[model samples]
Target chain A: MIAKEKFRVCPDTGFKVFDTTEKLIKINAVVAVVFLAVGGLFGLLVALTRWPAVHLLPADLFYLVLTAHGADVLLFWIVFFEVAVLYFAGSVLLNVRLAAPRWAWAAFILMLVGAVMANVAVLQGESSVMFTSYVPMRVAPHFYLGLILFAVGALVAMFVFFGTLVIAKEEKTYEGSVPLVTFGAIVAAIIAVYTIASGAIILIPTLLWSLDLVADIDSVMYKLVWWGMGHSSQQINMATQVSIWYCIAAMVLGAKPLSEKVSRGAFLLYIVFLQLASAHHLLVEPGISSEWKVFNTSYALYLAVLGSMIHGMSIPGAVECAQRRRGFNEGMFGWLRKAPWGNPAFSGMALSVVLFGILGGITGVVLGAEQLNIIMHNTLYVPGHFHGTVVAGTTLAFMAITYLVVPLIFRREIIWPKVAQWQPYLFGLGVTGISLFMMGAGTLGVSRRHWDMAFTDAPLNFDVPPAAFLMMGLNGISAVIASIGGIMFILVIVGTILFGKKRGEDACRTNPVILPGGGATVMAAGSEGTLKLPGTIALVSVFFAAFVLYYFVNWKYLSEVWPLS
Target chain B: MTEHLNSGDGKSGDSNGGPENGEQRIHAMQSLLDNPFLLLFIGVAVPTVLYTVWGVMEVVQVPIGQ
Candidate 1:
């Protein structure tokens, strides 16, 4: 039970910050960054290995690095930070003490042990089954065990989040509906529970099969169940990052949603429809039915896509409305131009929204199409699309929020403010290049999983186009740049937390909340709360144009292929 | 003076629980979306049926590979 003495009123935000909640957030965030560095190192090796010019790692080492890269960054680093976000959202936003603090620690321990175990297994080289760790690829038992334990731990953290909500309500933290950011986090937590459970359902049996406790696991069954966990984990990231986008918009720009009902409705659509897009992974499988694929990919999946489009409109629309109200109303683009570009939080968020929507959202619908998938499935395009979503979108947004989290949660000023300002552009542009080049190579029919694109060692090599080789080289160079950006972020955050100057008590105790670095909090400059955001309308129209153009281009590409009866 | 864009609404619907509006009620009944227990139930249950269950059933009916 939390006592009054255990709670401190945050001088900046005025949220009743629980001592345990703050500590948990600090630990989770620090550990998450550690894994990010580890994952980044492995990822650089992977990119170099993929480059025809460099080909850094041997084939075996390449697979090992690839396995570690996927697991560490995608599964461990992201989830750990997400757990931190859950604590921040569920407890701090609601102004409630975290429920079951001891249980939260237990969850962290389980996940850490699992992550270490899984990493050790991969390094041993016998368990290099890659991220999917598909059926028939028997691995070291600890590999599956590590992942299983990790999932269970994450599942426990979600329960703690849920419990914190219940406590918020009991203590009467706030009146009316919960805030929208908290609402989005709840959506993520719920999806996480399902994802972790799905992981356990498939992995436990696979663990048994690895030990020869079961004779054989069906390949088709494994793929189907695995993606329920695999891809849904991504869906969890999508919801959470989108929530962070809203949080950042409010913090830096003081933006509000255009309409709560419409925004919440979009989140609701995610709950009902987002995970079905997981079936996109199985669209190429012959065992799956056309009826099932059609429904999952296009029919129902479009509803989920609509959910994303709604967010794309509303987040910027909110920002645009906020900017105009601030009297930045010179022209359609003035609000955007006069907006806080110097703020890494705002820039990172803007990049995440634009790149993810334009690159990830468009290619996602394309790959999900059962017909279109015939060209792109299992190609470099898949990773390219996710790099846009996870790296450019989610990871960048998370990095953006760290600018605030350091000052707000950690009570520290950023070490190098200028580097922090430029970090997002460097990382965002680097990853954009990475994603684009990979997509280009994929379009040219380059393989995704192969270590040597040149096939210098293959018995019989089908020559890939020279452009594909050029794209692969460009992708490798981009990875180097992104790696530098990623390392810069890690160094800045680490320096800030460990050595940067501590923020003094907010003598001002200003209304609303104080922004990090004494930046402007989003304010109400308009009386009616009504602004005709022609700029947002224009920006979104541009997005729709790009989407329409890309969609037909893919169809045209599909048509140029050999005819099938 | 809430950081969230809730200008004149007097509700602190921002990320940080903003300044409390004058002496609001102890507890408020939220919409179905705001109810975590109910949302978690439906979020988990529906996805299981649509993606996991429906998918596994389709895979189950497939004849074993030679």
Candidate 2:
């Protein structure tokens, strides 16, 4: 039986006996990091194999490893960490315990089981469906079973988060409104529910087909629903990463935004528009109606980009506001000089935002354009663009959060604080270097996911300048360096866990000098208490109008084109 | 050190005492039911059972990707 002491709670102080929620968050973070590292290694292997000069790994091994890497790192690691962040948002940020701790653990177990089964099946060569897991290229039944189980676990976690929010409201733990971070998390969780549900619809049918229990499933239908999961999940990633930016900025620099109202409003905008932006992926795919694709990709996606721009400006605006308060009289860019650069968390966030804006933003918008996409589709540019946003933006934010969370939750001093300082720089430089190289290669027309271009009739010419191959080789080398940097990060975390000093008497010191007034300052100063009912109503009305307009326009065109078959 | 850390001193500045704390404790207890572990179990189990049952019911035998 679980000990009563383990389950004990102090209501007056709002502390749990075991601090299970905090423990679970740390565990999930570590697990996700491990998977991420494995994924990175796999990625490096694939890049090396593809490089013209150094074809290190064999062809079959290359595809298999790439599939595993995408599934484990991109899908599993990011989602699991997001769930961990969801729990942190619910319990810690909102100052409410989980609605169901037992159920939360159950979800973790299910995800673990599912992840294990999927990984084993993939490694054992029973499945090689790629990360997309497109039908026709089938895997064993267990692979699909594992994927389904993982999705279900994710869905349950989402429900628990929403349920916790409702209870927090009912109990009146905090007055007026949910915290901004928690609010963002709720929006992300809602997106997750839709994404995972769509994934379930696609994967479950395919799983049956793999087992010889179903004769055939329509490939077109599978691709359609699969993107629902694929694209929606990326939206969730975007929302959660943006929210983390806020949290990390706040914690690291004692920074508050110029206007909490604007920041929170931006989050709400993401909830309404982000999923629609996913149509950008389907733009180049065949079988989808041109009218539907055009509307979804161009108009809807532009609105999503508008939301991203709002967030993009707000982070700097918040920093500028904070700096102005500190009496920094420098011009627009001078405020950047006043910003804290020594603090690893602050620097990491600052660099990530800049990289994400210039590299990720420019490339992404260009790729999303219908005409430009026709040229760049399925090319090295696609991965380069995504890596800029995901690895440089989202992963870097997660790394920065580790600096804050490890100290606060685990009560462990970080090991080699100076070495920890260089991690963001090394990793960021490597990623940027690799992405630029790939972008250059893409400009010269290099295709993605190909094993050997030399064997094909239309082989990539080594004769004529060799610039593309040279760029690709540089990208591979950068990946190796980036992998080393990632390893250094893991070592720091492990060392902190094992060898760092534990917070003894200091654990009871509730107030830190950094955050002078603690929770009260945030609650009172921020927009939580302000009820901008008019603004909220206006926002909702705009969303509804946009939805109706998009629906009618697309419906009219689609009807004319297809004529209901 | 462990004993000293665990021991409750009268001078220790913990505000709420015994029975009142118990009431708050009960409220907190009620919240844990929606924990991720329990949700995860239900999420995985329900889907697994449903999918397995569906597969069993369908008796088609064609090679994959035909």
Candidate 3:
């Protein structure tokens, strides 16, 4: 097979690039962007409708747009990119030919068909059950079928990832452990396997019920099993994005993990504890044991938080250490201040780390508390929290990596480099505003799924505070800004891929500012490999202080909600 | 300069840069698999044990009928 196969070593990065893997990665990434465009458009409509002033869509259209938005952005776009990431991490990183290239194509087609089918079903106005599609709502059969096909296809692609790993091992691609990026990807794939299996367990039955083949479905049972797939999919994102963080840090700064064993231990903790977050959704629901809820939400889930905390510390610690080694050591913050912020890759990733750790991580800990969930569980705050994690964290990280992928993988110079430099900041600011304002409105008790925040059309009108209305209006404005930023991203990625000038091999053959020797290896700076990380320690202290303050604030709010004293 | 190294450690660099011989490739992979941390069982086994014990204790400690 080795003698028979023909592949090229990327001159810029020195990774073995298989023709099929290249085709697969390119196609998946392009399609993922297409979904992002569609989803972002739907999201703008959703924002306008939620604004009391705008109220853009009627109730029916609002739910439909919301459904499409969730499906496209959360499920379709992210997973398609993830499939590409799996292939990149597996075949390219391991320097092995992809196993079962033909099957990989089949998986891609199935996913594309499923995604389009689900979207079409939503547009038809019969499947506007939102992404959860909770039981007894009774969506069209094709809606469930579309999701099932998509899950199965994704599962097949995951298997292809596994097969590629085995092929790499059998072919002796690398030594010691797999690279940490590949290691994190493996964690994602493992979690994805369980998630998709959970989907099959619940969804297959629900599909039967939808078709009237089965009589009835239990709502609680459905939610329990559904979240195993639903929320865990986000867990997959968490792990994958963390992996990309490591990759970006290494690529841009030639950084290494603070400690391989500790980092690996954190990843292992994710494998054990991350999916327990699904229980957060079920905390306030009845009939589930308090013991189960308490354990899942508090003790075990905190371990998962610990995993995230480790990555948060180590990723920046690695960067600071590497930067200092390169003589950027004027002050505690000089290394960070002197970082390559002009590079969209570095800026996007850096913002993603800060926003995710501060906004997502803190809010997540608050929500995961069994008692504290009562006030905010069904409010707009839930989506606000996720926006912090998914959009600000994962999507931004993915967008950051796309900057590198365009040049390295597609062999094109980035078009409009100046615009690319500012794109992440604009996007980050808008998304941050959206998250904050929505959470503020939710604190005043804005319903998550209600189309009109004003209750203008409700049978019995209720007064939502003036501040809530103001926050909704601000959310509308923020959405417009974010939409512009998103458009800029799509334009840059699409324009560059299609029309950007071909990068000469000589120009890419060496990356002197980052990697040495034309990207011959993932250069990890700092020969000593010690954790003299005062900067990271200070940062972590600040994070903990914020976390503690927010935790107590939420508890105080919870107490005020009950006036039982 | 004789052989290019991939993303692993120094000593285990492929002798000829490419996968020239089956035995050499197998040897490299075996060394990776033999490492305690890399093996899947060693990686996840302890966490699984800890979670199980923690779960049981929480279940026992929960006040019944609350």
Candidate 4:
């Protein structure tokens, strides 16, 4: 007979947490935070170097730091946290014991080794090629080997998640379907499989080329395949963040999806069309055909945008529905107004949804358009768009969820509750400023990869408008602020985990959080049982209006650039 | 209502309420999500529309002389 498992039944949500899953979640989360600290430091250096006034590093060092920043923040930190999230969704939410605990540990070790190898390669100054690593500009063999090892490790972790889901099903953990959060995670894992496969297909050959075993690695072919992994990795973030959005809404405010059917449809949409967004990276490439280009950019892409727009609406709609049910139903936005604004979990997610939808989602659709891609394709605007999506949208959402993780999983009280409340806002404001200023600078034709905004040492000196310099200076200040916010988050989470008092069962009973206050009750019988979504409708309309206006504005801008003759 | 979910009184009762009742409710919800027609609609309809849009854009972008 299979051994009976021990479960720590949470007093708050009644979740049966397996000891192994809990341990794995804590290890992965702690490591993710450590990488975030390293990446954030590198981010500061890159930002300062980009600022004309400060100009912190020389060109070569600037490139090295930039490479490290991208690899750590974008790949290492995010993926590590995502592995934790995958385990949480499969084992914790599904109320099942984790499968293959030994294998999971092996996966974590491989990931750690790979991440260290990659970072060491970059810092040793041989692998200064940026995150894209477009070749014939080759790095050392270890650089590619590091990435391959990390990918393999991450892929193994995903298999563990899948195995856990199978265990949940066979063990009859839940009566109906798995929880929606688990379902969303399934989408992320599925996409991750595709992404890792894509990465291996290209990276292995490129590694051979790097080692001089292969004759040549074509640049055009590399970009086409590399983007399949590169851009699709962000799609994984999108799915995971949206999943967290739902979790935060439910845990913090006691919300449910407005319609589970429609919400799942959106996730289904992501699985089908979201990867097409990778085409935006190849829009300017000459080797690609127009038929392929147009199909990916406009036709295939708009459908994917529709999927995101669905989520962009449904997430907040669910939140509003929950808030209104709690008797915050005075006006159209009273649900929003009366929300637990002081709770970092709720506020962080709320800001993530808003800023991402406005800054990231709109700019992404615009950038993907065939004609408008010309205007901002390789400019500072590219990074601006990502910061909005990846940082503002995904990273902030992850940060919001960590507040819940500390209390719910770790069973520790937040060390500084008051400071935690301000962390999201400070970080949100700084990132927003970063996205806007970078986009503004790009609109004035600021080069993206250059260390010097002034281009002082170039053979041919180019004069950009003075506004670009001002934008870079402003971006530097914003980066500093964002870094402080990052530090605050790390301190709050680490301090809480290490030093905060252990909570008794009674504390868990009264307040679902290990944090200071109680969460709003999540009742199945919400006011949302009857459809009352006028507030959400109005909000969604505003988003639609902004999208249309910005899209048209980009088209107009494209028209003004070297008239279509 | 708030008190019910907040204290988790409702959740505990629902789980212990009866396996049959819980399974029936879940079955009803899962059927809609699992329907082949709905799955096809979700997976295929958007890409088909996108393809049509691609065709139109290609026609629009055809050079004036050619």
State which candidate has the highest DockQ.
1
**Model 2 vs. true fold: TM:** 0.79
Q: Residue A30 of model 2: what lDDT?
A: 78
Q: Which residue ranges in model 4 land beyond 4 Å of their true spot?
A: A509-531, B1-66
Task: Tell me how each candidate scores on DockQ against the true complex.
Answer: 0.29, 0.03, 0.09, 0.08
Candidate 4 lDDT (Cα, 0 to 1) = 0.81
Look at candidate 2 and tell me the lDDT of residue A148.
Answer: 91
The best-first sequence of candidates by TM-score reads 1, 3, 4, 2
Instruction: Assess each prediction's global lDDT (C-alpha) against the native.
Output: 0.85, 0.67, 0.83, 0.81
Clash counts for the predictions, in order: 1, 25, 0, 0
Candidate 4 interface RMSD (Å): 9.4
Q: Where does candidate 4 clash, by residue pair?
A: none
**TM-score (2 decimals) of chain A in model 1:** 0.96
**Number of the candidate with higher lDDT, 1 or 4:** 1
Q: Chain B alone, model 4: TM-score?
A: 0.39
Residue-level lDDT tens digits of model 1 in A261-286: 56777898898888888888888887
Candidate 1: stretches off by over 4 Å: A1-5, A457-460, A507-531, A563-565, B1-30
Worst 10-residue lDDT window, candidate 4 chain B? B1-10
Question: Across the candidates, what are chain A's individual TM-scores?
Answer: 0.96, 0.87, 0.97, 0.96
**Candidate 4, residue A269: CA error in Å?**
0.4
Q: Which 10 successive residues of model 4 chain A have the least lDDT summed?
A: A514-523
Docking class of 4: incorrect
In angstroms, how far off is A136's CA in candidate 1? 0.3
